[model samples]
Target: MFLVTDPPEPPATDAFVLEPLRPDLIDLDTEAYLTSPDVIREHSCGRWPVVGFGREDNLPLVIRHWSDHQARRAFTYLFLDPEGTSSLGCLYVQPLFPYLESMGADAQTLLRYAGGATARVSYWLRQDSGPELAASVAERVDEWLRTSWPLDSYLYRATPEEEFTVSSLDRLPLDRVVIDLPAEPHSYLWWSAQVRGGTTRMVS
Candidate 1:
């Protein structure tokens, strides 16, 4: 018993928009264009917890429909914890779920976003290298990104000539745009989506 009325579309959890986020605020308010007090306390409040996903062959690859478990739509937002943005810290968003429930698409968006993704040398700290040592590299990489992203997208890694620190925020595309929140810095190794939750099946 089969009837081919209309095939079917992909899944909202897939719809996404990557806007610069304020470190002091929670996930994009989808309300205010700038930071909000309520968002800060609810999400950031302080370098609280960071949820990471996707893989970076070079740039962040936002996988559409992260899985069947998620609920809301998501995207990456880069922000700092003091009051500005950081070039070193990368934020990657997961696929949307609600959108799928709405009979939306997941593939086309992922494909499109992937085509537009690319890591631009927005800012970098070359404390180990020298002052502005990354200027050339940044320029080169940014150019490559401008081209590559439109095709398959890309990610850029801090070269050996780059150094990352608090001062790195000074070179953002926007002027002192990011806001930092109060929080105790903690150390946690970044992992992939697969390793995030599933228990390691330590087969003895």
Candidate 2:
């Protein structure tokens, strides 16, 4: 229900940097992932968080998956401070698989929305960080994606447990869908954008 109005600003002095996830860094990332549930509880929508989060038994699997950054399958990033010494948060990006995968659509459906270059993204900032920091990290990574990938538009979605929030293209004629999986109910307030003449813009 809110929107982002201002242009991106330079990151703060203690700004966070995004790095591909790696196995060597799991020990450092443990705390962030473990504490994520509490943070999610406080921040995500419905005020309801997932259970069994932060269980030691799950760390190994979580670490193993994100350890590799597969551009096509998925791109996971660990957010760290400027010094690159600690984990502050994380960001994940991939195609619209999670949102559109079970729709039973044919190739034409994919072409209509993706056209070979649309992406889906998710992110979370440490509970201790200011919301502005989360916004900045999103902007920085978005610009990076624009320059480094073949994307025409990217879809930023709220976690299923959270209320839908959009910025930048909040007022544009954007694509949307509610993913009501039997196990989980969530909505996607997707925003689409395209790069034209060296500038990224909402596709409206």
Candidate 3:
């Protein structure tokens, strides 16, 4: 089993508030993701709400996030507007070991990299917020993770230009995986079918 450190206090940011993603905030979170631009959705490896995303699709995912946070397996937080009335984006902090394993990294690579890094961090902003807000949030998050979080190193998943690789190992591209899954009704059966079919095409 993968073990992880207890979560740190939500970082204080000048631009927004960070709160644990809970079931009650489902509606706000769902709306934020469903309306996110295709660029944001593509960067999320199709895990974020895609075309045809709905409340029903978000419910279980939110519940799982809540469960995982309670179990300390992973943590998800919503970035709320200053008034705390709605979500602007989301943050995910996941244990490095499991993340690497999921990405099919071999044991040697895991042993070499996971020893120093504690978590893999990623985040996204609402498309309407514009690129300036996104850049600000990214800067603030990087500072928080480097200064406040108790870790020697962490992986920040971003676009190719923004991604900070922790080692010489090339970061795995996720486009094919994202392309294989159907845009609607993101479910296990469809995912399994796509994997077994071994059909893939470039996204561009």
Candidate 4:
């Protein structure tokens, strides 16, 4: 922490911006990262650094701060720089596969791109921040990532063999059993080949 230095004034922009979440060293405290999991405590696939983030004033960061207030821990802020206030985004990084967990099945597959270290960013804004201002803030972030992180750093979707890192589970473990469920209870269990779009079939 920077010892709660003087709050920064609102950044002037026509779009968004992103910053890194470095705990040590002198960080302005504007980095975007996923705070926690909707299910598990963590979604660690590998390691990622703060890459992108955002903040929309209309949807200010009031909720996050409030949650932190309840927990008495610093809330997870986005890497996006809010317009103004003592409020600032705190971004961080993890891995690509974990980030997909938040995006659902279709999104999870995207994790295959993450090769080495990946980054998960967030967007944050103060209660007073607005859309225009937030948009401006978010744009700056995109610009930052374009310049800062190399294309290879965030290739999460790439296979390990391709990127030299096996991300997803390969062969099934002995203890696990696959089950097919139907949308309706009365309906016969509808089994699709490969769970997704593969040829392996458990039920014909």
Quick one: best lDDT, which candidate? 3
Q: Per-prediction TM-score, please?
A: 0.21, 0.66, 0.70, 0.33
Clashes of 3: 0
Clashing pairs in 3: none
Task: State, as a TM-score between 0 and 1, how close model 3 is to the true structure.
Answer: 0.70
For each candidate in the order shown, give its overall lDDT on alpha carbons: 0.26, 0.55, 0.61, 0.30
Order candidates by lDDT, high to low. 3, 2, 4, 1
Give the alpha carbon lDDT tens digit for every residue of 102-122 in model 3: 656555556644543456666
Per-candidate total of colliding backbone pairs = 16, 1, 0, 39
- Model 4 lDDT per residue over 1-204, tens place: 111122222233434333222232122332212322210111223332223333332123445453442342322333343343222333322344443444442422343333433343333343333445444443444344334433233221221121111111111110111222222122111111121122332321
RMSD (CA, angstroms), candidate 2: 7.6
- Evaluate model 4: give its lDDT: 0.30
- Candidate 4 versus truth, CA RMSD in Å, comes to 16.7
Clashes of 1: 16
lDDT of 3 at 81: 84
Better of 1 and 2 by lDDT: 2
